[model samples]
Target: MADPNWLDERELTAWKQFLSTGAAINRLVDQQLKRDAGLSHQQYEVLARLAEAPEGRLRMTDLAGAAVTSKSGLTYQVGQLEKAGLVRRCGCAGDERGIVAALTEAGWQKLREAAPEHAALVRDLFVDGMSRKDFAAFAAGLAALHDRLNPPAI
Candidate 1:
């Protein structure tokens, strides 16, 4: 009898493809962002998240949640950004202990400069490779997996 715990051939293939494709995409995106924008992928993500928040700022905890990073990891990245003058950290008014990360004008300018080329790279490397129908199905599958892994807090 076959081992029930092992992936079947199709499942194995899909898993391998998912790992390899994700790694390859991450490497390429990281390289491109570093080369063109002088920012790491994580830093860019932080800036983007802050830019989306009210007043271009968010509490550190909320920002960590939005960025899917640990508090320590976010703190490290925020430190780096602060050193570069791309982000500023301030005490939250409502909570003395709470910290907020606010994107500086420099950060906004950096994101604006980086976004167009970043979008083009994404489209070229990933989006353009798949047909619209296939891309939609792929996106739906990923979204379903995300939802399953991160159920809403009731």
Candidate 2:
């Protein structure tokens, strides 16, 4: 076999730091959202995606994609949101069997109420902690890595 490629010292350090920081950040956000909005980060993400879609609605698949969640996970989250009166499911406009998730008025209100604190948390933990130039470079690098790791289909 050809020589195996592996992470060098710097790459290994970056990888570990990236994973730990991401995990810590996710936990912090989830804790805040749970305490304030009774929502998980993923649930908030689902609602946020639906909120931005045309007419505050999106097909189930589209919402899942936008939220970067699996279909089953999205289904469960949507069900939870539905029970809370934050969202409603309906038959898709073009396909009877296809489901759509639509944000309710309550959902809009919840998002609005939760947004300011959520944004502040993100800025405090991530954005504002870095110099503007550093933040920009970090974001650009992560975007490139993310795109490479999850390339678009033809």
Candidate 3:
């Protein structure tokens, strides 16, 4: 009988592939962003999320959540962006204690410059490398995993 505690050969291979592939992709993305825009992957994510938000702004807490980073981490990244003149911090209108991060024109330009190369890299490394059927299945699997990890709040 097979041991329930151990992954079978196929399962082990899949698990190892997932970890190594994800790490490789992350490293490549970080390197590409840093080389092309002088931005780290986390900073790029923050800028992209802000750009997608209404009025190109979001409360710090909301930004942290959207960026999948801790509040402190988001704050530090925002501070760095502020220093670069790419983002600004302002008090939220309705909530005195709420701090909002707004993307500056510079931020928009940076994101614009970074996006094309980023998208092309993603397509080259991930999308074009897989068949449509396989890609769809992989996407579905990832979506399911995401949903499982982040269930809706009551």
Candidate 4:
């Protein structure tokens, strides 16, 4: 016999809306960046992560984790950024085998210029449509789910 946990109509609608919203948000952000700054959404994420680092630098492995991408995928994306002169690889001061990825001045400038438009896109796509209280509850719920799935390291 088959399991009986199939989604009801409301659940199905919510699931489909989630998927569609996610895809549409991605497409909007990607298209905006590509049109205005010539960067893909993934590339923008790499830059954002580097910009978040102290001294605008992070170890490649840390960058991969922060960007939620595989090591090989991060390497490929970093290589592309390097070729575009947006980021640079520097030797780790203490570890011979570790390398730091640093966002260049050009990268910082690009991010600054793109930020306003990117933020507007986010607002237009989602934030403006939601109630602040509902959004907060939604974020908190997702955080709880994430903590449950990936518990604190102990």
Candidate 5:
């Protein structure tokens, strides 16, 4: 078929580069998290989100949103963490139907221990490679793209 509103050479090249670099970055981050924390990147993210909450606890629905994962996927991952004694599920006091996922003491300790190494890896593999000005520009552009793609829920 003939090209119709197809990407020109420059656009195609840029798209390919963006995809390749993004994949590489994802792999590096996941590997670093696994190596330094005995945690997958997703698991680390879940713990970090919980840690930032007021009481290191969030509703399972909120946790799933924060993790940007499906409910079933979040349930499976949280199950693994629960099995590892990294977090526990508690019933929400105000909502009998709601369950909260809270980071366990062991989870906090593991995250604390892995913090430095994780930061170092992120810096060395990603942030350090970008100049401050360029990084800011990239972040702004990414934020715009994300907002455009995902508007807030009504």
Candidate 6:
């Protein structure tokens, strides 16, 4: 009884393909955003989250978690966005220690402008590139993986 956990050729190929494709998708999406919208993918994510939040605002801490960025990185991004007139930061209501990022009107407009093109690029680069049947299977597999490993918090 030594080790039974080992990936065969198929498993190894699948793993490598997932890693490379995921990175490539991110890179292409980022490039498109930068070229078409003058925004980076991370910046787009920050703006998107803010735009969807109630009153287009979210706490910095909450945003950091949602955007999956470190505190310092979020701070830096927010500052950059502020300079670009895409977002504004303010003191959180009733919380001296809390800061909130709010989507500016300009930011909302920018998002509206960028969304269609970004979506098209995503569809062309990712969705359209996969067969519908394969897409469904991949989606199912991902959902199962997520559900098993990261179930919702009670």
lDDT of 2 at 77: 97
Candidate 3 displacement at residue 1 in angstroms: 20
Which of 3 and 5 is ahead in TM-score?
Answer: 3
TM-score of each: 0.95, 0.95, 0.93, 0.89, 0.90, 0.90
Candidate 4 per-residue lDDT, tens place, 1-154, comes to 9989999999999899989989999998999999998888889999999988898899999999889899999999999999999999999998999999999999899889988898899888878777999888878988998889878778
Instruction: Let me know the TM-score candidate 3 reaches against the reference structure.
Output: 0.93
Model 5 residue 36 lDDT?
71
In model 4, the Cα lDDT at residue 61 comes to: 92
Worst 10 residues of 3 by lDDT: 1-10
Q: How many residue pairs clash in each candidate?
A: 0, 0, 0, 0, 0, 0
Candidate 4: worst-modelled 10 consecutive residues by lDDT: 121-130
Estimate, for each residue in 51-148, the C-alpha lDDT of model 5 and write its tens digit: 99988999999999989889998998899999999999999998999999999999899889988888888888777788999999988989999999
- Summarize candidate 3's per-residue lDDT along 1-154 as a digit string, tens digits: 8866989899999999999998998899999999999999999999999999999999999999899999999999999999999999999998999999999999999999999999999898888889999999999999999999999879
Candidate 1, run of 10 with poorest lDDT: 1-10
Q: Please report the TM-score between candidate 4 and the true structure.
A: 0.89
- Clashing residue pairs in candidate 2 are none
Higher-TM-score candidate of 2 and 5 = 2
Which ranges in model 5 have alpha carbons more than 4 Å from their true place?
1-4
Q: Show model 3 residue runs off by greater than 4 Å.
A: 1-4
| Winner by TM-score | 2
- In model 5, the clashing pairs are none
Per-model C-alpha RMSD: 1.9, 1.2, 2.3, 1.9, 2.1, 1.9
Better candidate by TM-score, 1 or 2 = 2
In angstroms, the error of model 6 at 7 is 2.2
